[model samples]
Target: MSQDGAEFSFKKIAIPAFGPSILFGLGEGAILPVIALSARGLGASVAIAALVVTLIGIGSLLSNIPASILTDKYGERWSIVGAAGLSMVAMILCAVAPNLWVYGLGVLLIGAASAVFNLARQKYLTEAVPIQYRARALSTLGGVMRIGVFIGPFIGALAINFFQLAGAYWVGVVAVVIAGLVALSMPDLVHEGGAQSATGAPTVRSILVDRRRIFLTIGIGVLLVGAVRASRQAVLPLWAEGLGLDASTTSLIYGLSGAVDMLVFYPAGKVMDRRGRAWVAVPSMLLMGISLLLMPLTTGALGLLLVALLIGFGNGIGSGVVMTLGADYSPARGRAQFLGIWRFLADLGSFSGPALLSGLTAVISLAFGVAATGLIGLAAGAVLWYWIPRSPKTPS
Candidate 1:
């Protein structure tokens, strides 16, 4: 088939492939807002509750390489199905937890499952989509996830009214089951005997040796991007509490921001495909950094809303950029292994973000810690500006 024909086929199949991601993201989103609150309700401190949220990142970081191996050997379809089932179990565990420790364990398992699931999808897309259409395809996937997140909190709020915090996990459980069924129903895109890499299968040692420089430089920027994004999620709720906003208000603001993010996904993808990845990357970090810097200055709910708008816009514009960049660097062969390492670094940043914010909060003020993330974002923006072009235009 021609390049255009292949791109068209990939695009057509992409939406179908996104079914599980949307549902999984929705389920996860349903539980995210209340994870900290539930831990606190179970007798944990504020910092400790936040730490529990980081457990997802930690689990993802630890599991990425192994998950990659699974995807590489088993193919993408089964890995996704397994992840969906495991995540459902994790949600059930979270729902039944009597204490913060058990709850953290459940969240950790969900994170591990999510890492495996996400890596499989990323690997599939990198191979499935053509270069010209890659960013758009990924951005659409990212957008769908945002849609799930945007819809989730409201569903969670309704669940909370009926069953409280535990109810949200029930919603997650149902969502995961639906997602798993969707995965089960989809045709096996991998091992359908599509394009196979000429370079042979990817191994960890070979990938590490080959991709070392990209990981050290541009990859670090991707990590920081992940860090900033993760920190925003962690910091915002705490910041809202510090401002004395109620739970409803916090959820409303976040949901609205997510809506804003969803609206921009397609546009962002177009910009990346047409202009360059840096076009979106630098501006995204700069906007997010500015929003974080302004966070400490927000004295009222209205002020916080404005900051959220900026954050939402910033985050929206960068949709799929990290995945796109990772795809750009990933070798055609052993793509899963390379993506495993790539996501590992990104998840490391995700884990570090909350921990770093918590540590800084303990040392200084919450405001200062939030401000520090802004500084990190700004630094990341600079790195992206310098490094993105210098990085490989296509996989080596």
Candidate 2:
């Protein structure tokens, strides 16, 4: 490449992507908190609310490849715009839906929006960063994105409390639109190659077929991610209300956790760059599992805040290490599809963890539900611990 060829910076992309990314991240984080309550407000039962999450997961699973193909065929910019546009529609539909069945369609669309937006965003990152710096670059991006998420729910809660359900929906629409527009402003990476986006015509089928173990690992990571997230996003709102707190406070707690993620995420990435992927990810996962185990026993905000810190720290490692590893393992061709494999399962975990854990509490107890999820996370860490191949670290 010529020295005069175009180059990118964190400010170049991160600044524009930040707004949309935040909207996307926040929606990713907050919906779990709101879904059950919103359903109940529309007169759905606990059983059905659980089903709502399951259905969303199904939609995410269905949309993964199509989203990748669309990104490849059209371009990353349009893919995100299309997704955000659909999400705007979905949220409005969700607010107005008269019945659970129609509401389910809204949920499906929301999941689909995430699929495309995520693919575009990741492809953007892959195209923008150099290989030596890729891990930290992705980590920095994750940290920023998490900051967006951290801000969203707190504001959403204020809207929910001040203006009721419609207010919350309105806030979400604005966020989706903002994110979409920012995506529009960014430059597109037309040609995919080198350390950045993939080059060549490898089939998505080959990537998925040969990397079954990696896919499994991704699934487990997603489950744990979604599992830990569900505890806060899906179940915590209900738990908080049961404790007699308002929606505002619940959002604050969620927001605080997001803040913690932002603060620690970059530092964690640096450690991964210096130490190694497994070195950081392994301990982060263990801490995350331990934090989940601790959540049920802690009844006070202070205790919960500490738990959030631990969980956030663990997540910081994962957000960096996992993406770095994904980029490393994935061949230059069909990178989006491989990242989709990474994201697809995690989204499944995100959708499933809340509902499944909450549903389990019906037969047992919330304490048991939290504990079960935490234990599963420990197993996930162990799995990654055993199998994550060590790659040669690039010179700084």
Q: Which candidate's lDDT is highest?
A: 1
What lDDT score belongs to each candidate, Candidate 1 first? Answer: 0.85, 0.70
lDDT of 2 by residue, 1-396 (tens): 001114645565666655577777766555545777888888888978867866666777789888887887677788888999999899899888898888889988888887788777777666566665566767876776677666666678888888787666777788888888878887766563544333446557877887777677655764565556545555455556556667778777766666666677677766666666777767777887788788888777667767776776676666656567666666556777777777776666676676678678888988788777788778768876776645434422
- All predictions: root-mean-square deviation over Cα? 3.1, 4.4
lDDT of 2: 0.70
Report the C-alpha displacement of residue 289, candidate 1, in angstroms: 1.4
lDDT of 1 by residue, 316-362 (tens): 98988888888888876667888899998888888788779989999
lDDT of 1 at 171: 93
Candidate 2 off by > 4 Å = 1-8, 26-34, 53-55, 157-163, 190-200, 216-255, 295-305, 355-365, 390-396
Off by over 4 Å in 1: 1-11, 37-48, 98-102, 190-201, 244-248, 390-392
Candidate 1 RMSD to the correct structure = 3.1
